[model samples]
Structures are given as structure tokens and as C-alpha cells.
Target chain A: MGQVLAPGVTAPDFTLHVTPDQTLSLSDLRGRPAILAFYPADWSPVCGDQMAVYNQVLPEFREHDAEVVGISVDSAWCHQAFAETRHLHFPLLADFEPKGAIARQYGAYRDGEGVCERALFVVDRDGIIFWSYRSPIAVNPGADGILDALDRLEKQENSDGRAQSAGNGG
Target chain B: MAELKVPVTAADHARGGANGQVVLVEYGDYECPYCRLAHVQVMQLGRHFGDDLTYVFRHFPLTEIHPFAEPAAEAAEFAGAQGRFWDMHDAIYAHQEQLSLLFLMGAARALGLSERTLEVALEAHTYAPKVAQDFRGGIRSGVNGTPTFFINGHRHDGPFDYQHLADAIQSVRSGL
Candidate 1:
């Protein structure tokens, strides 16, 4: 839970009701890599900018075969409004009632602020966590930062898979 | 030979004392909206209680996120030094978004301070240490983020409305 979602640990899956999109569960996204961008609140200036950045760079995410999703403690209604206002192409999942229950499960909840800090998680095709970064509540861990890390994980995994195949052939 | 261990004094902190009453200690950044929201409640509580409660504002700037927060906090402290702390505090909250030196100086002018003097104070980096001290104090007291408050030393662990905060303060008063 402390900074290492490690390479092999299976991600804990939950079905969160998202908006302007549909409900999503980690299990439903199996057989494909995905990125979860956990932000503090929707409609917040910084958060709006973060999602907009993701929308602009969505093509880059598609090239990596990854679906990017944003989660927050805001209600579905708020997410809908925020998505419409910001023109975000990605789904913004509502984690409102429990107030950071999932964020705490992911070790992104900050005790002091009573809100989920900004965090990013990359899950592999096998549903194992590949990369993660959680910024302190106030600062944003920009989408580009996550993309860079995701790129690294993808390259590393591909090279390892190729090496394993060569060994098997040998 | 004995190692000298100095005890921290209450005078060292404007908020700490054994009043046995619930004191709402708010560790906030000037630029934080949540802090601004909670500040309004703090002011309201003053009207509701009428001298029965104390609210202490501690500075904890998330400098990495809000680049101007620390500077704003320092300016507030400089204003506080001239007995205009609360006025400047309110002004900052009132003008949270446009947190520029020029805006702060305008606040100083509105508060009847010499603009030149306040500008020099801001440029001197005068109150940064005090604001930084508040952040260190918050960390030592288990504050990991902004808008953290302690109701009679028990942390307010969730989003709170005015009623909830009033109730907590009442509980502390009864216990005292």
C-alpha cells in the first residue's frame, strides 16, 4: 500500500457508478491495460486542467492500448456537470458517499485533508499493477507524467516478454 | 553531564493552552477554497458563541501546488504584525484567486497601511519563517494536508458543515 503497488499484485477491483459514460469495474477492463487517474475533486481548477490535458493527449493513450479513467469523491451529478463544462472525453467515476473508501484502499487518501490526493495507477493486461504515483493533495501529478511512466512500463514489459520467448526457443 | 532538553512553551504557539474547552484549530493555506469555506464557519461560530470559544488559524501552505500561497501567507503575517492581521486575512480570503503583490498592496492600502511600507515588508520575506513554522507545527500535530482542524485536540476527520462544527465545539465546552 505504501508506494509499491508492485509489479505482480492484482489490483483490487470495484464497480463505481461513473457518469457521461457508464458504470465501470476493474474486472470489466480485463485483457487490456488501463490507467486510473484519481483526483481530489471535479470542477476544481487544477483537476479541470488535469482532465483537459488527458482529453487532449487521449490519442497517445490509445496508442498504448490503455483506457484512462478519472475517479473522485464528487457525486455523479457533479461529474456530469464537470465533464460537460471541461469537455473531458474520459469517464469521471463517482466515489462520493463512502468519502475516499476506495482511495484509502489504494493508499491515496490523505489523513489531514479528508480527501483523496492526486494519484495515478497503471494496470497491466493481466490486471497486475504496473506503475503508480501519488502527489500530495495540493499538487497535481500531471497526466504527461503518468503517460511517461506508462510508456516505460510498456516498453519494459515488451522487452521482458521478448527475452522470455527467445529463451524458450533456445 | 546532562543533555539540555528545552520544553516548548504555550506562548510559543498562539493556539495551545489547557482551557479544557474545544478549540477549533484550523491549519490552512490562504489559497485553499476549503480553507476559505471553513473560515466563514469559524467567523460565524464567533457570532454564535459570543466569547465562549476560540478559533486559531495556523498556516500550512502547499507551496508545490499553489505557488503563491506561501507569499500570501507571509504577507498576511506582515499585516498581522501591524495589528491588521485579521483584516488582511479576510482580504486574502475575499480575493483568493487574484493573489498578486499588487492586489495585496491594495488590501494594505484599504486597511490604511502605507503601501510602500507593506511592499517592503513583503519583499523582505519577513513572515515566511512564521508560516513555515506553522506548517512544521501542523506536521508534528499529524496534519498531512490543508484545512485540517482539531476540535479540542480531536481531529475533525471528515467534511463538516457549520452545525457539525458547532456541535463539536459544544461538546468540548461541556467536557470542560
Candidate 2:
């Protein structure tokens, strides 16, 4: 297992291919919360189930103004096939050129495994990581943690805004 | 570390005693081979524990991989409408190798369900929302894969072999 990026640190920004002709940049989605799910590979048993679960709960994620993206060492072509087969609505970013480069920036890359560990990072609207978790290689590490973190972030933002307005009045 | 967020309720399709000492909940997909294997073990556990265990089954179909899963879950739910959910569930798993729409219709016929009603239900997806509800409930309960089990509301991270599960249940009973 790999160490997760600590909360409160600015998330490393990267642009990765989503399809043969499309790409997604981490920084571009900064105004809204983002969830980065790093997995070992495409088509594997555990990875397929994990991603499918996320696909099912997309509405819950969107309720908190969060966009979910999956990253792996697979190529764009591979991702396209997998996404089509699974009917996955989220973009699957390919870290294929350097193989696990984006995963490494998030501390999710494994040195000798040639793949990324099953990791999750929740970045707040400000691009700072609000929570992170590294699950056991075979476990799916369900979405509860991500939802809890997003809920906390929403509460934090509301409180911060209230304090700011109160200070101004004073 | 995942715990069952939603406890088994009156709305759930369950077997065994309602006030049993141990409640075993399985989030399963009808089309997954591993879930088939776990199905046998679950049956064994039920027989071994008898009245002491209350077993609940929930839908967690990996519809992308197991193409027949979602429809199969709906078939079971449709049967639930007739108060024969367990019969449909057992038939589906028992005939796991033949999970086609035709086979599902035949299973419903064998279980004394109206074939026309089942066909209409399947075509119109009458029970799809119910299955979707179960899937969402499974996600909320931290289910990431098929055949995931929760013994007394705590996620069972161990293997689903008979002895492992039986021992876990025993330990939980002793703790209580």
C-alpha cells in the first residue's frame, strides 16, 4: 500500500487523456469539489466492481457539487473500451504515457508493482485535499468516506461564509 | 471498516426467525459466479444455525460485467410482489448457469407465478425501481463487491467459506 496525500495540501495538478480526443485537467475542476479515484488497472475484478459502485452513486456525489474521476495506468483506448462496456458516466483519465505519473504525484503509485494502489483523494473547491484514504489492494473501499468528507467540506464552507459576513458586520 | 448503514427492516425480504440471535446480511449479484459459491455457503449457514439466524439478501449487481444481474434482480423483486421472493431467489441461484430472460420466465412459471405478468413486468421494468433502491441501499451500507456479507451489522472482511463465517458468527454470539 502507498501513503495518501495529506489533507490541507494543495493537490498536484495534471491533465490526462479521457478519450482519444478529449482530456481533463485537475486544476480546471477546482471551483467545485473533486474526487480522484486511483486504481491498479482496468478490467480487473476488484477495480471493475469499485468503479461500478461509484457509477451507481454519482447523484450523491453531484449533490455536494463534486465531480468524480478515475485514474489508472491504462491507455485511453483501454479506458474507452472499459467505460463503454460498463456504461460508466464519469471520465476515466489515463496516466499511461509515463505510466502512473499522476498517481505518484498523489502518493498512490507503487514502486515495484508497476500499478497504482487503490486510493481516494477528496479535494475541496479551493484545490486543497480535504481527505484521503488508501484501501487494501483487494478491497473496494466504498464511498462512505468520500461522502462524509464532502459533507464536512460543505459544512465547513457554510460556517466560514457565515463567519466572514459576521466579521464584516462587526 | 465498513459497517451496515441500513439495518434490515420490515420492508426487506428475509428468511428465518425475525428475532434471531444473529442477523446475516448478504449484498449479492445473481449473475456473479462468486456469489453462486457464497450462496451455497449461506444456505449451509442457515441450516446450521436454523432458528438462531435471520438471513437477508440485498441486490448489488455488477450490471456492467454481469449483464443478466439487473434483470435477474428485478425478476426476484417482481416475485416479491407475489410474496414469493425467496422462491425466485433460490431458483435463480440454483439455475445460475442459465440466467437468460427466457429462463427467468420459466422459473416464474415453475413457481406458480403468472407468466404473462412476469413478462409484462420484465418488459415494462415494473420492479426496476425496487432493485435500484436495493442497490443504493447496498452502496450506503458500504458494499463494494458482490457476495459482501455483514454479520450483525459489522462488515465481514474475511473469506466467505463456511467455517470462517460460522466461526465468526460463533464469536459474535459468544461476545453477546
Candidate 3:
């Protein structure tokens, strides 16, 4: 229910902790399409269900050459516990140092609530935001939209490649 | 808002007429308690609608929470291989609380399935890919939770209680 970071903009880049010792930057994931799942908090009911659904569909995401990363205001320690408890295979980056700094960059931070809104962003291989959605905090917004965007991205890339080949021949 | 991305095909485990007036597709997890409750409602719906409704069940196992979910789904798929998918499906929900490897084998036995065959299938994970396929289809169809239903290719966004689902079916039927 908030203004999402619109498509076609260069997605704001950030580095965040995935584990106590490991950190990942958005720029590092630019060569492949990536899905950023911004959620309110770790260990909440809807958040748990949302992440679990993504975990189950990781293979499908991979087929489209996409990698998923969950971002939240929770600390790295909290994320580690929740990720382990849920058996999440994807990295859950903590936006905790400045507390919602990365989320604020994407307009996903709920200022007064002290949490991030439930949102999703699909960043293309070139780091441009391809699609984004802000869902109600209580709803587990399913993976359909992300997959649709990825499908479109794949088709567009195919056409672009064909056009480039035609240009070369000309 | 969500539509069924993949149409039901011969590979799906379905009941009732192939050309039935209404099709009800459920994305269910065998280990989910809500899915167990919905199972009874689904059965009632089948009885109430009879030949007018085609019921299809697909796997959406929350394996992280319910460790046995994937295995239970695999058991059902193995039963499907022997042409007893519904029987295994029914047995699993009926004995929902007793979902263990041994219990699944017992259910297979009760359905007159070869216990040896099921054992081999489970150990070999012969049906895991089929369960994974169902899960992927459910994700593509916008299934966010257990017991998600789609009637006539549209996601049922309301509660899945008997009354609500019955009315939903009626509405779709009347539209047709």
C-alpha cells in the first residue's frame, strides 16, 4: 500500500550481512537476474510463509537464471536463526546496521511502524528494476507475478539478441 | 486476481467427468492441518456436485515446516503410479495425525498396494520429481499457502470453508 520503486529505474545498491561473517552486495549479483523479497520482520507468521513459499520454488527461479535474497530490518543473528529454522536455502540479508536503510532506499520502510513493508523487486541482469509489488503485510504475495516478469524478461532478451544479430548482418 | 497458469492434463490426479461443468483444483500439502480439514470439505463437495464437478489435487508440500510433507506427497504419487492416488490421498488425510514413513506404508497396504513396491519407491525417491512438478505448478498458479483452491481457473481468495466453497462453485456454475 505504498509507492513502490518503479520498474526501469536503477535499483539502489547496498551491501548487507547474510551471515555473521558473510556479506553480499546488490552490485555483486548484477550479472544474473535477482529477486529481492523485502518483508517486515523475521519469525512473523506471514513472513515465514512467504519465505517458505519462495524456498519451495527456488528451482523454478533458478531455471529463469534468477537468485532470490530476502531483506529485512532484523539483525544478522536473527536472520540466521530464522533461516535455519525455516530451512531456507537462499540468503536473507539484514538491513539492520542503519536499521531499514536499504529498505528506505526502495521506499519499503514503514517509517512509524519501525519495519519494512511486504514488498518484492525483480532486478534484471543489468541491475535495472524490472518489476516490483507492494503487498499487504498480512498477505503472502505468491510467486506468480515474479515468474511472469521473469518470463517477459526472458522473451525480451531473446528478441534483443535476435535484433542484434540482424543488425550485425546488415 | 490469480489465474491457474497451467491447465489440468492427463498427468494430474483428477476425479469426476473430464468434461464436467465445473473444475475445482486444490493445491494441498498432506502434512498441513488446514489441508486435512479442507479434505473433508472437498469430499463433501464431490458428493454434493457429483458429475457436475471435476476435482483435481496437486502437491504444494511445505517441506521445511512439515518434514514429512514431501515424503507423504511422494507416497501419494507412488500410489498414483499404481492407479490408487485418491485412495492414498484419502488415507493420508484420514490418518493425518499419524503421518510417518511407517504409517504411509501401512496406508499403502490398506489400499492393497504392494508394500515392497512402496518401500522401494520411497527409498529410491522415484516420485519426488512428480511432487516437485506439482509444487512448481502451484507456485506458478499463485498458491501462497496450503489448501489454496482455484475454481474455473480463478483463484479462490475467500475462506475455503464448506459454505464459502459451495457458494463459489454455485456462482461459477450459474455463470456457465
iRMSD per prediction, in order: 11.5, 1.8, 1.3
For B25-128, candidate 3 gives per-residue lDDT tens digits of 99999999989999999989989998999999999999888988988999999999889999899999999999999999899889889888989998999999
Ranking by TM-score: 2, 3, 1
The chain A TM-scores for the candidates, taken one by one, are 0.86, 0.93, 0.93
Candidates ranked by DockQ:
3, 2, 1
Residue pairs with backbone overlap in model 1: none
- The reply for model 1, stretches above 4 Å from the true place, is A1-170, B1-20
DockQ, each predicted model: 0.03, 0.52, 0.62
Per residue, candidate 3 scores C-alpha lDDT tens digits across A1-170 of 35889999999999999999999999999888999999999998668878989988888899888999999999999999999998999999999989999899898999889999889999998999999999877667889999999998877877667323344221
lDDT for residue A90 in candidate 2, whole number 0-100:
95
Between candidates 2 and 3, which one is better according to TM-score?
A: 2
Steric clash pairs (candidate 3): none
Tens-place lDDT digits, model 1, residues B128-151: 788867765554454535676677
Better of 1 and 3 by DockQ: 3
Which scores greater on lDDT, model 1 or model 2? 2
Least accurate 10 contiguous residues by lDDT in model 3 chain B = B11-20
Error of 1 at B92 (Å): 1.6
How many pairs collide in each candidate, listed in order? 0, 0, 0
lDDT (C-alpha) at residue B95 in model 2:
94
| Model 2 CAPRI quality | medium
